[model samples]
Target: RAASYEEQGVDEIVILDVSATLEGRRTQAETVRAVRARLSIPLTVGGGVREPDDAARLLDAGADKVAINTAAVDDPTRLDRLAERFGRQCVVVAIDAARRLDGEGWEVVTHAGKNRTGRDAILWARQAVERGAGEVLLTSFDQDGTREGYDLALLRAAASAVAVPVIASGGAATVAHLHEALGAGADAVLAASIFHDGDMTVGTVKRALARLGARVRA
Candidate 1:
């Protein structure tokens, strides 16, 4: 699957072990190694990365960047530690944000969106960047898998609060959705259902983006 996405012209690939945090285990380094051996583009790996050693293992296994969620939320200093040990450019902060019930704003959620930390998502993005996270992976918990569209409001808020690149994720169903995300201030967009279900290919999406006047790699 990773090789196919690469072949289809994906600029990068992100593999997250969604169960690692919930299951209390580390991301399988062997799995990352296997996937890394097949791809030439950049790879980002995450899940259950609690310490610098964990991130190191993934990097040694061929991940260009290591993403952290639960651990960073549990201790913001962990981001500092990771960045200090492996350069800020190698650390990607993965934030799962869910809209508040009052509809006021979004709150940060950890452990794959099962735990709400009550931290303002926008503020957290700024804090994470200040703490040395080179990039922000913002996933809208409400929009994930819904395929209706990305939470443009959330994307705008987070992107505006941080200087680093922000990758919009969750709820992408159409080429227009990706275009809207970019217009909303996302540096990049991440989608799973549309690609995994065979509804679209990276090449097709890039073509559509190009038609929409958004620059895309060939």
Candidate 2:
């Protein structure tokens, strides 16, 4: 799938171990090493990264960037340290936000979306960027797997709070949702279940965004 997407002109690739945070799963350095040996495009790896060493190991294994989530929220300084050692461009912060109907605002979730922290998503995003995160990957739990649409409110709020590029994740049910995300201030849009289940293609989404007068990687 990576090769297919690359051939289709995808701008970048991100491979995350969704279970890494909960079960002590470490970054698959060997796997990444192999993939990097084969591919030329920039690559990002996330999940189970807890410290600066974990981030270093991934970069050593040829990953262009390392994404920190669960651990970064607990110690955002880790991002600063990683950036100091490897440069800010190599550090990407992934923030998983789950909506709370209690009107508490969006709370940051961790452990593969299983654990919810009371911290406000927008505040966290601001802090993450200040800590040297070059980009932020924001996933909306309310929209995950539902594909109704991205949580545009969350995307807009986070984008407004941070200066780094923001990638909107989850709830991309249709090509139009991608357009809405871009219009809402997302630098890029991420679709998992929709593309994984063949509900839509990345190329189709890009074409739709182009038709809507949005700039997308061609």
Candidate 3:
């Protein structure tokens, strides 16, 4: 699947073991090594990044970046430490945010989205960036796997609050949805089922986004 996405002009790929944190297991860096041996585009691996050592192993195994979600919330200062230890460029802070009432804003979720931290998502984005996270992987739990659309309001708020790049995830049902996300200040957008089910092609999406004035790799 990683190789296929590359053939379709995907500039980068994110491979996450969603069960890592919940299961208390380490990231499968060996699998990353296998994929890295066959790919040219940058690869990001997340999950089970509990500390600086986990991030280090992923990098050593050939991952260009390591993403942290539950660990970041479990210890907010971990982001700072990871950035300082691994360099901010290699650390990505993944934030799973669920919409609050009326979709006015969002709150952070941890433990693979099963636990709410009661932390303001926007504020957390700012704090994460300040603590040395080079990028924010923002996922909307409310829209996750729903194929409805992205939470543009929440994305705008989070993106506006941080200077680092924001990678929007979840609820991308179509090419237009991805385009709208980039327009809403997201540095990049992550789609799953839409691509998995053949609803869209990466090359076509990139072309369309470029035509629509989005600064995507064409």
Top candidate, metric lDDT: 1
- Report the poorest 10 consecutive residues by lDDT, candidate 2: 1-10
Give the residue spans of candidate 1 off by over 4 A: none
| Better candidate by TM-score, 1 or 3 | 1
Q: Could you give candidate 2's per-residue lDDT for residues 1-218 as a string of tens digits?
A: 77777766677889889888888879789988988876789999998988889988898999999999988988888988988988889999999998875966799988766687888999999988888999999999888888699999999899899999999998887888888998899999877777778776778777877888999867
Instruction: Show the colliding residue pairs in model 3.
Output: none
lDDT of 1 at 214: 96
Each model's TM-score? 0.98, 0.95, 0.96
**Candidate 3, 1-218: lDDT as tens digits:** 88999999998999989998888999888899999998999999999998899998999999999999888887889998899998999989999999775655789988767787788899998998999999999999988899988988888988889999999998998888998898888999998898899988899888888888888875
Clashes of 2: 0
Please give the CA lDDT of all the candidate structures. Answer: 0.94, 0.87, 0.90
- TM-score order of candidates, best first? 1, 3, 2
The stretch of ten residues in a row with the least summed lDDT in candidate 3 is 99-108
lDDT tens per residue, model 1, 108-199: 98876778889999999999999999999999999998989999999999888999999999999999999999999999998888999999
